[model samples]
Target: MNEKTVAGYCIRCNDQGYLTDLEQWNREIGLEIAEEENITMTDKHWEVIEYLQNQCKQGVAITIRKVGKSGVVDIKQFYQLFPNGPLKKASKIAGIPKPVSCI
Candidate 1:
């Protein structure tokens, strides 16, 4: 399937057309998104992604949102704080891990 068909969003660039709609989560795309977000190896977002990558490699995978205390919020508040709503791009900047199953 195409990246758009899969992730529902394109990951090629930061623009609209080069962009594909985000469908859902996939490990390959997740890693790509991490790279696109410019997440450094020493950054907090990288820490979370590294943890998640380890877990996934171990067959003990977990979603990103559940790894921290930020999970304790309602939908409205969650989206308000995360306007883009946890895209890997924004998450890396915010120093939070990308949403495990997000597109």
Candidate 2:
């Protein structure tokens, strides 16, 4: 697969532009991705992002309902935090792939 560049970093991205090389993720890349998504990273947004990153590291599968149940934030708040396609966008911004339950 072809890799792309963002913020001067080589990135392997999917059709929707999520990182395929999880190890290549960094704060700079996350910020660039978030900017591309039109999201301003706030504390609440960080909460969910951190949660997803931690879960991903633990090999946990994330979902809207699972995030809601995780107590980091509820489903409505998750959508509010990442509007539109919350799980997909959040996972992408967190430098993880789209969740299986997402599509």
Best lDDT among the predictions, by candidate number:
2
Alpha-carbon deviation at 66 in model 2, angstroms: 1.2
- Report lDDT per candidate: 0.40, 0.86
lDDT of 2 by residue, 15-37 (tens): 87888878899888888889999
Per-candidate TM equals: 0.32, 0.89
lDDT value for model 1: 0.40
Per TM-score, the best of the predicted structures is 2
Count clashing pairs, candidate 1.
9
Error of 1 at 43 (Å): 1.1
The segments of candidate 1 whose C-alpha lies over 4 angstroms from its true place after superposition are 3-42, 64-66, 69-103
lDDT of 1 by residue, 1-103 (tens): 2233213534432232222323233445555544554433234444444544454445553443544433344335334333453444444332233345556
Off by over 4 Å in 2: 101-103
